[model samples]
Target: MSAGRAQAFWLRNLTAKIAAIPMILTSLVIFIGCSIWTVVYSFTSSRSLPVTDFVGFRQYERLFGAHRWSLAVENIAIYGVLTLVFALTVGFILAALLDQKIRFESIFRTIFLYPYAMSFIVTGVVWQWMFNPGLGIQHFVRQLGFENFTFDLISNRNTVIYAIAIAGIWQITGFAMVLMLAGLRAVDDQIWKASRVDGIPAWKTYVMIIIPMMRGVFVTSLVIIAAGIVKLYDLVVAMTNGGPGFASDVPAMYVYNWLFERANLGHAMAASTMMLLTVLIIMVPWFYMEYGRKNKN
Candidate 1:
């Protein structure tokens, strides 16, 4: 580019750039700086305080060896996978139904999206009550007719993670639906006409053409749900408290417990660093594909 053109590009959004300077500095100093600090401390033998005595991967070794941490990791894996699959499937189905130009569309959208507005804690509490064996679904069902029915999944060790996933899917599916609906609406009317002209089925058009076109929206929903799955502490605390012998424990809860309850800052930092790395592994490539390549072009 010519010198004058380069100068014009730099000065094109001068005021907006000036306004963004504080935010950019804040992100660099707060987010990146604290992340580096945390990773550094993860190598140390700090307990109840931040210490300089670096012990390499000793803290990480202990973190991985702990049974509680293992359970937490396993639970998160199961929960995360189930949440992702169900949220995407259910959300897309709901969005497709809404796209049919049905009556009371806004009312249905509001009803569906209402759960996302509620805090995770509130969702957890409400679901906990509904899942309570004595006073909830089980009792209500038995009173009606069936006395042999037992719906105590929340209190069962084997099924507690599934219960957590139920609450998570309920609260997040609506948000996914909204995103998918927006993506569906963005489809060109001519594309549908072309598909119809070719005698293509609606489902085939969606699967072969429309979904591929909505790739960005799908990625956005995936990232949003994945982030929530990783940081799944609040709902677990409110509903299960990692109970039934740490059956529903997740990584974030493990990190918090090690840091505060166990007073093992190094271990907590190590766990948190692992979570950060996991998020980056999932996000960095998507970021590059979505934005970096566009910039280069």
Candidate 2:
């Protein structure tokens, strides 16, 4: 607390502040600069690498004309809905079972959740093989004298999107279960007593009373799931490669292909821009309702 010591402390902080400027600058240079660059490139008729000349809205015209683009948008909706429903249901059931004081809680939890920790590349590959017809679950089961064993959804045009959803659910449900179980565990023990005293059966109590009490947890889970829906890419790439005539193509894959593969920077940017807008349209209101309006009320 001497004057000399206080002066030294302020000097050290000042020097540290000066040192932090370069770090901040480096981050902004990468993040903000690249984002602006993407937006700029989106307005031009650049291919491969970005060019200076601009073509306003022409790229948007070509992008909308592409069947792949349209299919991708549709595929995202289907994948999002199927994954959300199945994952939430399976996760809830598993969580409830695990929460019932099972004999091997840790083991069961780990088994379910361990898949979520694996890289999507690995999950996509494993699932791709498992759903493949000749060398996977189908092969083994078909040999068991069930001659018409069919699990080739990965290659089927009508069902390829569901294959991606299956893989997604396998990887994501465990995490969702962990969330639901945590929410369920946090419910007041008094609620269980109240339900019992009111002559409510356990199943009815959970469905009618307890699950409703965990609305916040459910909303949070759904939001997380929704984000995954919007940015879906890697698994579809590894598993289906958007094959079987663009059956499982998604916005992320479309943007990536335009940006890198075909070098259609303008269209790529347009796709990316549209994606950003779509996410905003979907999420802004939910966020407003959940956080903004709640505060106002």
Candidate 3:
């Protein structure tokens, strides 16, 4: 082709790239604008409207007014800690068992991991039925002459959160097992042989040696689990809908109500932002300590 034609083609391509720049910039601007708008809205006295004037920190003060915020916070703490502990424990155990040349390792791994693939909405519905006193284990057991059998935690106000935790652990631990198993498989086989030759009990080897070596995996799993907890929503909505009163109310639900039902967009932003901040607070230090400090050396 002639140089003039080639030059014209190059000029057209450059022009197109320049024209596309504004679209990218516009998208970024919109995101930033919304985020700033949300924070600004949270401070206004406007309810059910796009409040422009600022009302200082009154929205934040009101957020702490009733028992709802504190109760939701308490529930989050309880649920988060319990789910983390139980899921990690169960996942580790299952992964370890499967790693030991189990007879049906493939089948067992699939069985353990299948629950992770299902959405929490379905899992929640199934668990709700299982926890039902009338149609579930409680009823079946009572019919077997154990009339005292009672697994009605889902119906009870005080114990409902634990019931939710049961489902959380069930769905999450399988995925955790997959992560842990991958980490476990990455371990050098030489370590296992050496431990065996040195007469280290299998359980002790896991506790003392294997676990320490798997710190990276555990931390990775914990970060992922913590993120899930901070953003927890679907299971609660599907299972109990934060029912039997406000017993199982979470920050996510609270934000949703404020945004839609209560029409308090500003307060919704504050509530939702807190969720983000909470995750950041928990993670930032750990990330710095684990990764940043290591890089410094």
**Highest-lDDT candidate:** 1
Q: Please give, for residues 1-297, the per-residue lDDT of candidate 2 as tens digits.
A: 699998887788797779998888877887577767877888888887779778888888988998889999999988889888988888999998998889989999999999889888889999998998888998999999999979788889989998888899899999999999999999999999998999999999889988999888888898888887899888988998889877889999999988888878788998998887787787887888788857988
Question: Could you give candidate 1's per-residue lDDT for residues 212-291 as a string of tens digits?
Answer: 99988999899988988999999999999999878889999989998999898999999999999999999998888889
**Model 1 misplacement above 4 A:** 1-21
Q: In terms of TM-score, which candidate is stronger, 1 or 2?
A: 1
Clash count of each predicted structure: 0, 1, 0
lDDT of 3: 0.88
TM-scores, one per candidate: 0.92, 0.86, 0.87
By the lDDT metric, which is better: model 1 or model 2?
1
- Residue pairs in candidate 1 whose N, alpha carbon or C atoms collide under 3 angstroms: none
TM-score of 1: 0.92
Quote the lDDT for 58 in model 3. 79
Q: List lDDT for all candidates, in order.
A: 0.94, 0.88, 0.88
- Against the true structure, candidate 2 reaches a TM-score of 0.86
